[model samples]
Target: MGTKESDGVDPRVLRTRRDVVDAATELFVTEGWSVVTHAEVARRAGYSKATVYAHWPTRLDLMRASIGKICDEADHPEPTGDLRADLVRGLVDFAEDLAGGHLDRVLGGLLERSGSDPVVDELRRRLYEAGTRSLEGVLRSHLPEVDVEPSLALLVGGVLTRGAFQGRPATEEFVADLVDRVLASTGRGEEG
Candidate 1:
């Protein structure tokens, strides 16, 4: 007999996990963290609550799995070695994500409950790292080692403020200008 691909685990179990996690992630992205419950996820995934509870055991567990999936699926533009262009592209993409409402919902929930628990704190950190991994790479390549974090903060913070805080569109021109300002302040504008 042929062995199963999932290390001898039944395919049904794997399917259940995928379905449950996918449902949880969709709920998180659309409705915020507070709405992701075992009951809701079970209904959305067409599985019983017992099945979800068996796999996840808690709301935090579901959030962790969903955030992990989000990080794993994060997509960013390819860096072409042009610092200004790359920064502009990255920021623009980030703005779009915020505008799409998915990021804002998840971020709003995380920020609303920041520091209430160690697990929540870890999830927040993971989400930030995932969201900024691309921009961090670009900054690290061109800026001084000491400046990467601040520059990343400035770039990402600017977009977040403009799009999520101010409730305005972070236009391409705005992002490009923001990138130019940061790069100029760091003495790396256009040249590196």
Candidate 2:
């Protein structure tokens, strides 16, 4: 098994580490972030408490690991040639993932922690990156010659503001309209 210090760790150890992280992810999502402890994760993962600590020494470490797993597991839709449809689809998926119960609460908890913990801030940044990557990809593909910053900002910021900040529903129709407006401003509307 992979120890805390070894690279040539056994496969079993790697599996155990993965199991531990998976358990942490479930705990963080289902329960509040406060409920995640090494002991609880160890019990959920069926690993020893020592193993959990060996892999993630601090609660912050465990949170980071769990958040990383969540980000890694995010679904990104592939950009078809139809930019509008792709943008709408991606935005809707993004909103749903963010607005869904477990993820929404997890994000809220992270934001609450971010003010005091740099590690939590970094985790939030990583989550934001993961969330916007698909939109960026679509913008880059469709507006290859144009600077994608404005459009990317509109898509991400608009969606987040409406869905998370304003607590409005990001329905498919809303996403479609948002995409249309953004693309229209960029001169890449229905014609493009």
Top candidate on lDDT is 1
Off by over 4 Å in 1: 1-8
Q: Candidate 2: lDDT of 157?
A: 77
Overall lDDT per candidate, in order of appearance: 0.88, 0.84
lDDT of 2 by residue, 83-148 (tens): 888888888887887687466778877988877977789999898788779888888987899999
The positional error of residue 27 in candidate 1, measured at the CA in angstroms, is 0.8
Weakest 10 consecutive residues of candidate 1 by summed lDDT: 1-10
Which residue pairs of candidate 2 clash?
1-13
The TM-score, computed over Cα atoms with residue i paired to residue i, of candidate 1 is 0.93
Error of 1 at 33 (Å): 1.2
Question: TM-score: which candidate is best?
Answer: 1
Tens digit per residue, CA lDDT, model 1, 65-114: 89888887889778999999999998888899899848989888888888
**RMSD per model, one decimal:** 3.4, 3.2
